[model samples]
Target: MPIVHHRKPSLLSFPMWLGTRVLLRPTLSLWPLNKAGMAGLFLIDRAFAAGPKPSGVVRERMTLDGRPVELIMPSGPSRRDSETAILYLHGGAFVVCGLGSHRSMASRLSKETGLPVFSLEYRQLPQFGVGTSVADAVGAYRELVGERGYRRVIVAGDSAGGFLAGKVVEAAAQEGLPRPVAFVGISPMLDLDVGTNPDRSSRSDAYIPQNKVRELTPLLDRGPVPLQGTRRIRELADDAFPPTVVITAEGELLEPDAIALVETLDDADVDAVAHSYSWQVHAFPVLTARHPETLHAIEVTAAFIAQAIREAKDADDRKDQRAG
Candidate 1:
């Protein structure tokens, strides 16, 4: 749960700064995230899909839990196991950036971890709220781990998807479901209350705005939201709350959220790692090779996942031997 540092040389500092600070920040902060905003997000997805795609990955579409699921398989010797998978939740404030914009990152994770990456297309804003999205995410996890028989799947996401990933584990615990092997929040919005705090105005965030908090936060209350009337970090660190690795850009709005998660998990004696990098955009890892920081974050996340799978498999092996 400590802040780790990396010194990899980056060549895209000026370009990334220009992209996030000048282009994404002003537009995302000022844009009215209404129904029309939903359309705008879709347009962004279309533009992103029209661009170049990641190579050496096999993409397939399917339905899990009756919702859309994009399974990205890395077509290389890197794929070592099909018994485990990575259930990735994309971060787009729970409104935009679906399978299209995030497939590259999912592919990167698949390649790095040697696990098939299932990018879930959960319900989002405009037509759906955060609660509905939570329902979809939790349902998808249940389907994968319960029905699909993937005992060591990793739940990971960025931005709002990170938010959903957290809710999924909490609900899984409450519902008597087996917990995920681990959790990874890539600059996730873990606390919905972070949207309401006026003190955050002094924080140096790249794109997300303070005004947009209350606008979407209310949506969290509209669906079958679990763990009511409590801070998420207050319970179940060693139980349903598994080991975690959360990544954030230094001074971004959600950096505190990442730190609070790692700290609480650490205090509970849960294995947790929080890394904050300087001079990077919010959720830069989603850019997938857009920055050296991004690659480092993904590499760390992938390493965490591989380790979790190893431990889980070993534990299962031990249990089987004892039963025999």
Candidate 2:
């Protein structure tokens, strides 16, 4: 998501901050980000400045769902004209994070999939709330397909972004817009009841506190542009969703969401897959590529997306052959 950067060391009180850090540091190592924990999560993002441009790639500004958005187009004669694109949602607990912090991840996926990626900067909590974010996310997809002539696109996100991906796809299915070819969720947060899933409540979850659900509830409820009682409905019905993939670390607190998602996909008869990295932490896929875990996660992500792309192409080809 959006990243805000600052050079100042003491953004707030040193004693209280140090106390918080001391308490949270052990848990921080369990997550991909060590310095920020969750509090400073939005600090790392600095705006992306246009630099020496790539020869064939095109970058432009556009508006989606009334919100300003970005589209990254690949250039090169050898690059295949993409029949598919990705509309990405970034996760920051519906509060922090945005397109800036997520740009690197988006760019890597674009390169790997050889397809343009659209990363939406949707409304966030304490301002726009969950419903607005989901609306904008779904809106981006519909606009892309209906107005922009993209036939097939995938909806993907990580952590909280993954939750939004599921919500948007569900909305699309209900609205009868052509459903995305596949859905990929990384360490998703589903089922608002903090106690509903024990896997998510375990002490070993390390990074995310056990009370995160309680903390997030008021934010999603009374916050600006709140969910307005639809949160439970979304959580319950999202199981019978669509062709999907749910990826998470087995060690993560959210593993149950992944399992529950698999069960939901099965109920819907959607072609689906769930892959859990054995010893991985949350959002391990977005780290520097030099780390072995990061490299492996990226490779796995690329392979999964490529497979989905190929399968989607095959289905279209078969349909064309029959029509011909």
Which candidate's lDDT is highest? 1
Clashes of each: 0, 8
Clashing pairs in 2: 1-98, 2-97, 2-98, 2-99, 3-45, 4-43, 56-75, 91-161
- Per-residue lDDT of candidate 1, residues 150-217 (tens digit): 87778999988887888878887788887788898888887777778665651466666666766677
Mind giving the per-residue lDDT tens digits that candidate 2 earns over 1-324?
A: 011111232222234334433565355435432223444555544433332233445666788878767677665554654578888888767767776676667776776677888988888755556777777887898898888888888888887788777777767767888778777776777655543445455454535665655555555543344453334323533444556666666556777666766766566565666666554456656533344544555666667778877877898899999999
RMSD of each: 2.4, 8.7
Q: How far off is residue 298 in model 1, in Å? A: 1.3
Regions more than 4 Å wrong, model 2: 1-42, 47-58, 195-199, 222-240, 267-269, 320-324
**What clash pairs does model 1 have?**
none
TM-score of each: 0.91, 0.77
Worst 10 residues of 1 by lDDT: 227-236
Candidate 1: segments with Cα more than 4 A from true spot: 7-11, 77-79, 219-240, 288-290
